[model samples]
Target chain A: MGPQHPSTHGVLRVILKLDGEWIVEAHPDIGYLHRSFEKMGELRTYTNGLPLTDRWDYLCAMTNNLVYSMAVEQLLEVEVPERAQYLRVIVCELNRIASHLVFIGTYGLDLGAQTPFLYCFRDRERILHIFEEICGARLTYSYIYPGGVSGDALPGWLEKVDAFLDYLPPMMREIDQLLTGNEIFILRTRNIGLISPEQAIDWSLSGPMLRASNVNFDLRKESPYQVYDRLDFSVAVAEQGDCLARYHVRVAEIGESIKMVKQCLAQIPDGPTRAKLPKTIKPPAGEVYARVDTPRGELGVYMISDGTDKPYRQKIRGPAFVNLSILSELLPGWKIADAVSILGSIDVVMGEVDR
Target chain B: MSEEEKLENTETSDKPLKPAGKASPGKALAEVTPPDPRLLALAELLQSTFGDAALESVVDRGMVTLVISPGTLLDTCQQLKTDPALSFDYLACLTSIDRQDHLEVAYNLRSLTHKHEFCLKVRLPRDTPEIPTVTSIWKGANWHEREAYDLMGIHFQGHPDLRRILLPDEWEGHPLRKYYVYEPDDVPSEQGPPEHLLIQLEGVE
Candidate 1:
């Protein structure tokens, strides 16, 4: 028997085979939120698919849109203006920060730590406010277009972002104090659900999951998509692939992302945010697998075009989907509470998981 | 019997030497794949190791996709996992294409050690699409396999447990397939009851 809670995030039913209090087998049942976004892409025009990408990873909508647009640009062989690339990097990093804040905040709530949740949401609200001012929507800003952005930055949005960064460190500290060193938090995470380096590699764990096992893999640095090659930031990694290591990795990653956002503000130049293109976009007949580092991990857009306005086929590689696979392998030996915590550490977005 | 056993062992032992590609130890996805020499060596390794099980194709992005027969998928995945030169330790993604003509499952394999990326594809008939599961090789394939099985209707032969993933238990069809269609039934016209309705009521009384 396992926790049969419905609102437990997308009708996730975990089948547990228990050895006394220890789980011997754990299986996750997903697809409750499957909207078939890929198939929908085939039916939608190139420009129309941007909004669908937003729904792919609801939490990291900007990043999803950016990845899709990047792939489209690749298929079109269009070079975006330098200014637009900088803007893309800035917004993507900001979205990454906001996404991590949700991860920390919700993870705290899941772990029974209420204070951190409020603290995280407080900072997240500021980020969302910034997003709203620029794109008119807070959560799913489908502002990114094929060549550049749909619009320019709003007045004083950069200054507001700087202020948010200035104010965030203190809030982050409070969250650290509230959970990082707490004895119970440590006990619950320290050596539990330990995934070895070899196992982590074998499982195709990316983002923080792979980083927790000491592999410093960040797609921004590796692939250098958008304006990432111009910006400088460190990839935060941990030697232990335990739940505690994953938590620390995400917290450190937020800090690094903040540093990248600051660099973007300073390096961004004055130019057109969007490129001149026709009302209809038709990319060449080809396929491309354009990847970007989202808040969760690597978000890839594998698109096949038939020299038409719509795609012949499109597949979105959701990072959460791949990361979620480790659940069954890791959850089998832990108690129910630990299972939830382990899942929290993996940081799944059911939207992406089912997409 | 002893002579035949000796010959079989030599053939297995004389398998081509797998390429030992260079790797940046600490880098994750940052590792690069050396072209030509390394890729050619990898192909040779596959040919000797799996016999005629490997089928190679060139995709639009200059990506090389290797196709494996369903019977050898599990064992082939195991070899890719353990082979040092072609250390495809990471299962980057698992997806199936719902081609109206035929169903195809694709695996994006990444070597975290050397940072090389490769793909594996397997095709199945529309009626009975099935393949061996690689969840045992890479735990990350669990949901991916399920999603492929659910939406694309491809059967994973050895998946520990396979069930409908994205659709509800009572849902009728796989939505991603090219042939999938959503149709609604005819609804009756809304109008006032006729004199026959009143007559029937009077008869019942």
Candidate 2:
């Protein structure tokens, strides 16, 4: 149905066998955007590979950077400074908010609601502006690095973030009013793409997809990393595993991210952001699998070091890639129109899917 | 169960409540913390059950890694998933690494109920790397195994629809192999417009 269709969201092609209006079978044909990032990573040094991760999931590049950096840090056994840990948490959560905002906006547009898209982008612009102030790039900020973040927060940068957090809740309410409670949005999404909890777990779904199925698994809560344990928050979950429930889970998570960021700002201590290390980064010969709870799901980085500056192997377990695999299993019985809603709920970015 | 009865029951029990390998009483508490009892128990359980099938087990970086023989990969995975003491239901990640001489596939597994995780590894000869698919045990392994097969040229014996996942089917060599060489000329470049397109342009003119 697409490598180009707007509803498919980023260059995913699905071959479907249809019976009148109902779909008999669906096979997702991905890999149109494969850049072989793993092969490229093996050719570069540990420090040089940070920027390549920015391309994996461009929506939340901060989390991608943080996860890769965590894996390298585990191998190097370097302890990040307290302030840098707080900064990592703040930026990762903010990126989560920005990524979810994109999901909500595009999801509304996919379901035939245009006003919410404009509202979501308006609020998302402020988050991008803050990111630009911190890292000088909006979409692909390689701000988080191994051992620590790239730089410390500027003099008034914390204040700027606080101001944006203050401005976000009201705008989120407006989006909720415009789309979440809309009758047409509910009618299109409520029971359209239902996934049982067992199916969600067996398929290894994560983030909002698994949470919508009532699986209370979040890496931040389960296995805290980067000052997440200090911050108090709740995982957003929904009992019904459907398109509408997934939407609700993401919307609720934006609020939780807001709470976590505010706490980071309040408890942030005055200290150095980057750690002191040798000029060359050559981790000891070993293997480690480090994972972080990204906005989409669990972004795991499995790194193998052979006592060289470059990695022996690096494998990225992208959540969108795994979440999208359930398409063929989920799309068989639904109608063609519902297929759009179901695919949109999965919210896959083809860059990660095909990488 | 009253609180006193619970305390009395614990006190009357024959087995001491102290952890299995307690340090000398003269040693300072901060000097050496003992190994985690849960991890020790898990290691014991795995060692007792798998025995010879489990080649080597090591605890490194706060994670348990069990190297299983290729012949016992599928059966070991089934038991890991179904065994109540070790319910590694979720296949977190599957990765294949090229070691220049031999190929290795690592499976990262986690049990949501127990909140414990481990790594399972299997070594195969580089030329003919093949292992039974674990998708029958955990459905999520379907794409992960396919990815390992696609990028590293590992063959799954009984995958339902094993094909190149992140690479096109016609693509030749697995790019993640240590010996793989990239040839720029291998990529097909676009020739000029097709004959049908040229004829259509002429008709329009």
Candidate 3:
């Protein structure tokens, strides 16, 4: 209904044809936040382009940086050090938790549960503090780069993360108690915007959206990148494929991320974080598609290098962009209020969608 | 578990944790590594099925890429999706590239059941970059094809609602094209709201 409506979540305007209170048809009119990052990637060197990735899907900037770096690393044919790989996994998973926390808080606010929103942000702030210690920025941390992370973890940084991890589970339980099993929340979300597994797969729905529909396709488990294969965790899935199921999958995933981060910290080795490379980064002429399982879904960076400092072509397959496309197919036949619930479950950041 | 125990457990696995980069410095990345047998077998199957339509196939960076002629794009995609052995149901990505000489569209397809993925490329002449849409084969191709059409100026023959996606409908010149020049003066100055928007605004109160 708007490019500014709070319930629509960041510059998503949907034109709806309504029959009384029910939507007859819905068309999502996106692209209000297009910055043309691909064009910018063409104009910058490989190292300079890392900051550009931080802008897309700003909620999980670490994973965005990780995927772009992975693509460049593949083209450069460079190996990241063992400790740097572990650091990448730790930060990416922590960012996943932070991003999901935003979803939980905002989704609660969208569904008229204000207390859970406050509780979620309270916990999310602590995670941001941890991120700030590591990267000096809370939101757009270009910490993960090609060949390695920007810097090694400072002394006692691991202890702070461990302390925060211990503090998080109890707070998460408080949020779960506040919203997950509440009668009003269940009434608003259960069976609303139901997507069948077949429909989910055909539409290329990913992350919690696809997993909620019973599709067990997680890029981390299926095709491991960084140190994901070393960390042991389960993919969170729900069979219902409704708004409630999506909520459940995300809540469960936060727990899994916590477990993975714990594993990364426990097994991190003492070594250099950044790899030695030439001053100029010019990857050989080839194309490589590197994908990472972000909090939202698969973030794939398709890069073609012409053996030059600048990329010949770069395309980002943002998961939120693809996941939000199903709104036009799913919105009809539901009431206008249910539209808010459905859109919240999709959890799209317009920066990624419009990029 | 202790750190040493974890290290020992991981080291015992035959498969290494890191996938070593195959390309040597200053060497072409695609030329260094030999094609995987599985990829070769899949390429053979595609070649046997499509004959001359499958122009060339190569394996680079552990991904098999099949370059097909634009004329056989739709039929080849349909077979790729429905074929039991190569049930590429998931269209992971659709990207269009301006190669300066010619326009190319790449389809990154993955089969959920088989857990194997590959790339399908279609080359079109720069003057008339047109190809049949694969929306019938994969519904997710809707926005992807629209995006390719919007940024790269590649026309999809059968896209149901092909329009400018990221850029405005009235915007001229696809910016992703290699030859496109950005003119700062092209930016429209501030003006009154459009007639339709004003009409909608009149009913707000």
| lDDT (C-alpha) at residue A280 in model 2 | 92
| Model 1: fraction of native contacts | 0.48
C-alpha displacement of A269 in model 1, angstroms? Answer: 1.9
Model 1, residue A162: what's the lDDT? Answer: 89
Tens-place lDDT per residue, model 2, B49-167, is: 88989899876554568899899898899899899988988889999999999999999999999988889999999889989998878888898888888999999999998999888
For every candidate structure, what is the RMSD over all alpha carbons to the true structure, in angstroms?
11.0, 9.5, 8.0
Candidate 1 residue-wise lDDT, A87-137, digit = tens: 888888889889999888887777778888888888899889998999999
Order of models, best TM-score first: 3, 2, 1
Error of 2 at A188 (Å): 0.6
Q: Whose DockQ is greatest here?
A: 3
Clashing pairs in 3: none
Where is the poorest 10-residue window by lDDT in model 1 chain B?
A: B27-36
Per-model TM-score, in order, reads 0.83, 0.90, 0.90
Judge candidate 1 at residue B137 and give its lDDT.
Answer: 84
Give per-residue CA lDDT, model 1, range B57-129, as digits (tens). Answer: 4433324567877777787888888888777887777768866788888888877667666678788888988
List per-prediction Cα lDDT, in the order shown: 0.77, 0.86, 0.86
Q: By TM-score, how accurate is candidate 3?
A: 0.90
For residues A1-355, write the lDDT of model 3, one tens digit per residue.
Answer: 8988999999999999999999999999989999999999998999999999999999999999999998987776565677888889888888888889999999999989999888888888988898899999999999998878888888999999999899899989989999988999999999999999999989988899999999999998876666666667999999999999999999999999899989888888887777666678997798988888988898898999999999999999999999998988999999999999999999999999998
